[model samples]
Target: MQASPIYIPSESMDADAYQQPMPQTANTPSLENPEDSVDDSTSRESWRDNKKPRQKALYLDNDSAPEHRLSHTLQLVEELIKEKEILEANKELIRCVALTRIIYGDGHWRLAQSYANLAHGYLTLRGLPAQAAQHAESAKEILLNGLDMSKSDEEKQAILGTLVTLYYTLGAAHLIQNNGRESLHNLQKVEKILEELQTLDGGKAVVLKISEKDLALALGRASVLQNKLNSAASYFEKVIDYVIMTEGDSTPELVTIYQEMAKAEQSRSKHDRAIEHLLQAHSIAIALYNKASVEAAEAGLLLAKAYAVSGNYDDAAEMYFAESLRAYQAALGPDESETLNTLVEYSKWLVQIGRNQEAYKLMNSTCSSHLKTSGDFSETVAEVFHLMGTICLAESKMQKAYKLLKKCLEIQTAVYGSQHKKTRQTQELLNMLQKSPTTSEGNKTR
Candidate 1:
């Protein structure tokens, strides 16, 4: 899923510069629950106020059914989450968990799902991956370890659905740590469960996000696990077709589909198609949202990368890239990992366009400074070192290049093990350095 780095708000970004929207939870308003409906007669604020009081009254009423009270509390939590009242949402979640435990014991399906919801909320909105990971594991444990197997088929299906939700959060949390393989494994488990259900039902009623229309897209996304770029792109196209059919034109939602499709194209080395999709996203965002919007800024960044990769190192491309970088920095600050990722990509562009010293300086000064905090064994740190080493090699600074490449090898070997593709590449690069008579650092040892 890696392409032009997408922003996942870090603690520094979350502090002031970036705000993440709440994720959709299964417990949220669905076709099954009409109580969460809106009335056109009332203002949004009035509706929220009216609904809260009604839910609160039901929640506190001793005569109300326990299940009904719990549902109302969850509904209120959903409202709090949507409004970005995170502290209130978390507090309410705790109450819901406690009540569920008291009523149905610790193994309650509702309790497990609530934990999964909180896990997702923390990871997506609060930029707290460690806490999110903890809750995600807990959700899985309670569901798999605590839940009884002897239950109705419907109950079992619902539980499995909650497990898929939990696995998705776990995958996101793993991605936060840059554990792509681990993230993929968790997401694959989700697809496996969905596939199993489909096999049992002769491919009927495949559980998917929001609606059955999403199942094809979800499976397409899951195809990424098999490294199937064409399959992934085809699935995203289905989603695109659905969007056009329902909305009659591209909207803000279409921007996400375009971006994902572009990512698939980029992964397949189809830079031209990637650029086209990203440009579409940029154009739509500019028209419907604004230039300063995060979506527009990100789309521009992706488009710039696509242009650079396609060897279009023109002034216009540079300006678009620089403009987008500056916008993101303003909105997300210079220290954000997302901003840093863009800076690295821009540095690579500079190198490709015959500005090696400028590229070297940007990476050596800014990227190196922040990258050190990513830990010595971090794969990201290894990649940065590899890039800097390559730049140094190009500049004929063999001694410095040898040292940097050696460090890259060390980190890559430690993190990826010697058998990994990246580790093998690092070794080959080092071997090439060793074979060079011009190699200045002959006796270097790491």
Candidate 2:
């Protein structure tokens, strides 16, 4: 469920498997006493009388001032979250929460901001998916309610930005749930709201940054849902350039963008570009020791798929299929359907590599598991059948091959229609099998 970079063992993991060291954090800024603020306020008018604007600037600056300290503090919190320093980020969030409470008393918009920051910190880190989802949902509720109570455009925009982030979190959760329609609906709302906001205020508003990143990601996701590989490629290409520009080409975020972009490219048959992006993503993942990350797994699988498609059978078999098989096995062990689908893809690669026996074994395992847990109606299972048919054909089992291939064709036509790419592919496979003679036929001819 949690995607991270794959880590190859240098020696072994037994020594460090259970020991996770906490990341370091900076100390929190101290808050001045209320009495000191009161004293300062009392002396303000006399000080203003004695000193000019430039001379009095230093004396008047207070931690409690809206522009002076709060803004800087919020920026610091944002930076910490960006760095993935969860504990320190939470510390900053709590401080902001306390400050907002002090400013707005309680149950007010300021306090809502603190909660939103805390929610963001949880969402950004790799480890806190469930908690992140909960906090994001809570922040969305508070921000929406706060919008009704506030009249200021800036305040409303800030709250709306948080709502945008919350929607993204919700969308990601729905994706995990395999609820494509719900995820698309939530993401569509975010896109619509952002479009409206851009029209009203243009870019550079507080909401704009969040909108840009989230909307681009959503478009890519929606394309995936619709199985429009080209459209997804377009969406990924749009934001990937921007991500590289802002985060540097080597940053983890940029690597993630490239990993997804590679998927789009691979789907479009851009094998060289796909392999290039995959390599970059894999490099970054390894550098970060992100071997267990989603990005790395995705990159490895995509690279393998690309190599298989490009007819580099040896590399596909040795590198791509091997790593992808390991990753898919790791992912599917906990009963993840997505991982099973990936496993099915790896099986396809195996078939391509002349590993019919291995592919058949994988399909059997996949078919058995899916039959027990869910069903055989999934696209993944359909693919497994197709691979099985190909395997049977390779082994000169014509009757079994014909049956499986025909079944696969029927399933594809039922799900995607006769004209769909996948349906057409299955049809072609079936036709080739029907026309080709087996080794047994050659023996009969002799």
Candidate 3:
């Protein structure tokens, strides 16, 4: 029996071949007019000069043969997807379902495959989980019926490939919708079918479209949603191992995996293990991209936060915080939101560790920068004023505290209005500062 033509790998097919005109034969209709055909004796150079390149038609008329329409639409889908026109490709996929039904009737496995492909496209390209699940359920019903009627081994294998894709689509859609139990159930079905394929192939590795690493990651995420931390950690570990084997340990791909593993460890209350994973990710990011790169800055910030959360505030947290701030400043200039935000976080950390003098200086500089870049009425400038005022209050600098708090209140009133919670809080602080004993002493001296 001939192998199923259910799927053709787009990469393996020559795009140029599809662009060329099909050869005219008794069975194949010619798109060109016979009167327009040039004489056979015409010079090749003249023919080349006179002939215009035919524009590729995107859609065929309903009168065209269903097989021809299907082939053309499939090629169009491949070209659209390659060009990253995912929305157009998805529309073509919907058309493919109709064409497949026209050619092979309702019960054929190819129709099921078309629905499965549409479901995958909906989920991955458009992020429409409900639509994806609806289409996938349709594919599942058809596949179950096809499986019952299948007689040949090739047919069974072909149906199984579509089933694998269908289940994966359903699993991913459910996962996105936060239906963890349903997601895991569909993903486990995919796993079972994969194992069955492997067994059928005599234990050789079965080459499915979905990679082992992606499958493991999806399962890990689903496990996490289910609060199965141990299972999630194991699956994430498998992903890390697979990635290291395939892409090397120092690849940037490992950074996200390490961070995910760290989160899982943190959820399990294993702070030390979480720190270790974060450090690994931070180091890898710094090595792969320079310390001044945004990637490194983000990784450093996460590592710094992890250190702070673990109470390693004295040296390690401070060092990483400073590193992150410097990196953010270098990658995105000092006036950028990321740089200012990192400065605020690091200043807060400094204050937490009783480095009040340093925190005050940083906040003082940030206040000036924020005022210059964002204006005095901006929330960021208001925040800088508030922090500086609180730092002054802590150190008994009542005069400076009163000045900063007054400025904070002014900005808060302008930006958030007097009735807002932040504005009211700033107003209360200013009132308290006015009633301080030091303020009374300073007033008497003046």
Candidate 4:
């Protein structure tokens, strides 16, 4: 008989910004544990407060039977994970690890699998790469030992499935820690084992929790981190092929992949290729959502930045920047943070091209809008005041610059206190304006 499969959660494996639909499988694995009731009276927030007491109660209720306690704890782990209580789920996973060791001994593959699952939870659920790496290493040691002792083909296959997840977790954890070489090495191991499993199953891909697309994307990212641009592009191409074959060509899922490809091309100084990928992404955003939508605005912002960096497409850059600003204003309102940020970025570009007067006018109006929306004491208002002050200083308007910097200083002092770097910087600017010859002449005349 085949060993009972342990299904690792694959919900977070997609590299795209948007989630793709996963097929429902009938053979969804379940632990054969007796059902235990949990108190549902407490809200999710209150559960944290009552956690210790509830855990104590669980142990006391099943104190005589380790099996019953393990079963109950495992059920709780499932419920907490489904409820998005990741911290609590992690704690339960720790408990599961200990219980698995007690019930099945240290050399058992199930104990190793528990450790692997916990490691995955640390990386994926909590973003703790160090803890994930530590646990994953432990899982690998135990798993390799167990693999050596396995007799049946079914048992070996099942253990190998767990090994796939274990290696994938290690790769992801190392990737998060920016250890690209280690990450790529572990992911290559995953690919090799997967190939081995396919060969064992008559030269076809085995059904595993982590899909081929996920592996391709992970490998691509690891390759990019390792500065292997050609290898990265190849893996990304595989991802593109997989996505296109699985989903249609025009799906929004293509947008993130295209953006990532553009970034890789940009890193390689392939500006034309980068622009091509960005243009495709922007066109898809426009076609899938309206031009005025937030999605289109974000895509336009990226395309505009790429054009600005190319230095030969100033007019095109400005046009897209203005369009993005307008789209953000229309979709999210004039005073929303996105609209304000887009306005600021456009103004910065104008200033970069020596359109100081236009940039000043734009920022002056934004100051009023930010004051009315985010209030005078907000960081956004302070930033606008600082930018306007800087613009006035550049234009030789000493008195205006002095007043704007004074306002900026006041806001910074109020929000960030007198000793803050921004407050001190604003004060220094005001001091320079005070000592200017033009300002002295203007003050004497007044």
Best by lDDT: 4
Worst 10 residues of 1 by lDDT: 3-12
Model 3 weakest lDDT span, ten residues long: 27-36
Which ten-residue region of model 4 has the weakest summed lDDT? 28-37
Worst 10 residues of 2 by lDDT: 1-10
Ranking by lDDT: 4, 3, 1, 2
* Candidate 4 Cα misplacement greater than 4 A, ranges: 1-12, 15-99, 125-131, 144-150, 177-182, 202-205, 371-380, 411-425, 441-446
Clash numbers, per candidate: 0, 13, 0, 0
When 1 and 4 are scored with TM-score, the better candidate is 4
Each candidate's lDDT (Cα)? 0.66, 0.59, 0.73, 0.74
Off by over 4 Å in 1: 1-52, 61-72, 82-84, 108-111, 124-127, 146-150, 196-248, 289-301, 312-446
TM-score of candidate 4 on Cα atoms, chains taken together: 0.75
Tens digits of per-residue lDDT for model 2, 1-446? 00111111111111111123223223312222211222334533553466445433433245457545456557655555455554544554555665666667655655555665555454444334455456566666666663573356555566566566667666655654456676777777777655544443322435232435445665676676667788777777766765665556676666666777777777678888887877787788657655555556666776676676777556554576566556655654524555666777777666665677987886677556553443445576577677777788778788778777777777777778889999898787766765666633643565
Comparing 1 and 2 on TM-score, the stronger one? 1
Query: Per-residue lDDT for 1-446 in model 1, tens only?
Result: 21111111112112111123344454342222112332223413443464556444534454766677677778877677666776556655655665576578777787787777767666655666666677778788888775775776656666776776688767656655656567667866865766545433222232322232243445455556557788788877877876686665666767877888888898898888988898888889888867766676788888887787777556756877776767667777666666667777787788778988887787777656565565546666677788889988888777788889898888898888999998898789888888776683455433
lDDT of 1: 0.66
The list of candidate 2 runs beyond 4 A from truth reads 1-85, 98-102, 105-107, 173-179, 201-211, 222-231, 244-259, 262-301, 307-446
Query: In candidate 3, which residue ranges exceed 4 Å CA deviation?
Result: 1-62, 106-108, 141-150, 177-182, 201-207, 376-382, 402-446
